[model samples]
Target: MHLELAVATDLPALHSLVESAYRGDSARAGWTHEADLLGGQRTDLAALQIMLDDPAQRVLVLRDGDRLDACVALANRGNGTVYVGMVTVAPRLQARGLGRLMLSASEEQAVRLFGATRIEMTVISQRTELIAWYERRGYRLSGERRPFPADDPRFGLPRRDDLEFTVLEKPL
Candidate 1:
């Protein structure tokens, strides 16, 4: 459960881990998957590289030896809050509590690395189970709705036109 700052070396495995955790037939093994709502790739390597290159952001990973078990990205919003995204775990290893562990680590990293006082994330509104999971982790709806990037197939191809995001936040 040692969390480390992701490097360029982690891109390929990280890409696979994320896609498998959220899309395609592989994601069905995990309860947190978005397979029912979206199609295509969850994320791509180029996008991951950009996140890693951003000075105000970091992609953190937890690994077991050579295994890329989990990863989450944190971006310093410069307003005492950090944006959390791409929370991922190995699909086959989901429900084993690794998501929680990654989240806790991300929170600690947020506070320690960016001096953040708050953490925020956006989840698809259609994902009730995932939203509830975050709520149980102390996140609450901010009542703000963001339209899903329907044009951005880089993340995923939406299955429904009503897809949108709900902001979730927690105080550190």
Candidate 2:
């Protein structure tokens, strides 16, 4: 597989890959599926388009031949730290180390583009398995919590009322 920075022109494929990786029936094939907790699309094309157009943010794509296999979004937070999110590997490709590759590439970009040493991400607190995955990747809990936007359909329709985010950080 090859890894590279994503361009605005990649929006459509990226959107489909992301949706399939996190939501819908396709996501259920992977351990990372949020289908049980959220019922709608995790993201939309407009939001992705904005991220692509933002000079301070970058979205990286990993491809296996012509197939888009994984992606992540890194945003410069302007404080020597980068915020990482929207990490998604093709559902069928999960647990095969592609996610790790995309993550490592994001961190390298953080260091190279912004001279950042710290990278932060927020995971839904209820996602124990996902949190553990990040822990194994060198991230530690920050003891910070943010209320998950209940009414934000852009994120997804929450399955439970208690959904919230737990912040995690890693130093590169």
Candidate 3:
């Protein structure tokens, strides 16, 4: 399998893929989606473009020819750390181990691209299954709780008000 950095032309597909993996009925086909917990867009094209433009950030995509299969975003937090987010796999491709492959690749890229020794991410506090998944991958909860951006439409429209984030970290 090959993983490559997403380009400008990939933004639209990235947006659609992320939405399919995180919202609407299409997302329900996947085990890793937030369809029941949220509504609205997962992310906007502008935000994606900004990541593409940033020297310290990258969105890696795994593709089957011209079709996107999976993606993960990483940001160099500096000081030997990188932040991982936006882990996504096509709904049809879920439960087939693609998410794990993508995540492993992301960790490799984090170290390769940024010389990172640690990687971190935030998951919704209510996603127990997801947190367990990460734990199996060696990430531990850092006990840091962050308020979800409930007021930010750029992220999503929360269906509930109790949403919050718990930070998870691992040494690469």
Candidate 4:
């Protein structure tokens, strides 16, 4: 397996992978599924395309031969920190440590490219298990909360009105 920085040309596969890993029935094959909490698609192709085209953002993709096994997006926060998001590993390949590999690669990229000392991400407050997974990987809750965008269909159709995010941070 090898990891590569994704380009705009990878938007389609990345979109499909992100959706399959987080939403819909295919997501159920993995422990990370949010299908029960969100009804709509997790992301759209256009938004991903925009992200790919952004000069300040990079989508790191992990490939197992010809397939994309995992991926994550890293954005420069302009404060010596990198914001990581859209982390996904192929549902069928979950629990095989691909997520950890992608995360470690992202951290390395952040430090090497931006001289960042910290990497941060936001997780849905209700995703206790997911948060615990991150904690096990050395991230900690930063006591910061952000209101989940209720009106943003691009995120997902929240099953409850109380959805919010808790910031998690880890030093590189």
Give the range of the ten consecutive residues with the poorest summed lDDT in model 3: 35-44
Candidate 3 displacement at residue 6 in angstroms: 0.5
Clashing pairs in 1: none
In candidate 2 the C-alpha lDDT for residue 105 amounts to 92
Candidate 1: lDDT over CA atoms? 0.93
Global lDDT of each candidate: 0.93, 0.92, 0.94, 0.91
Q: Give a tens-digit lDDT track for model 2, residues 124-172.
A: 9999999999999999999999999889899999989999999999988
lDDT of 4 by residue, 83-155 (tens): 9999999999999998998888899999988889999999999999999999999999999999998898988
Error of 2 at 120 (Å): 0.3
lDDT of 1 by residue, 1-172 (tens): 5789999998999999999999989999889899989998888899999999999999999988988999999999988999999999998888999999999999999999999999999999999989999999999999999999989998799998999999999999
Q: Estimate each model's TM-score.
A: 0.98, 0.97, 0.98, 0.97
Report lDDT (Cα) of residue 116, candidate 2. 91
Global CA lDDT computed for model 3: 0.94
Those runs of model 4 whose alpha carbons end farther than 4 Å from true positions after fitting are: none
Candidate 4, overall lDDT? 0.91
lDDT of 3 at 111: 93
Predicted structure with the largest lDDT when compared to the true one: 3
Error of 2 at 125 (Å): 0.3
In candidate 2, which residue pairs clash? none
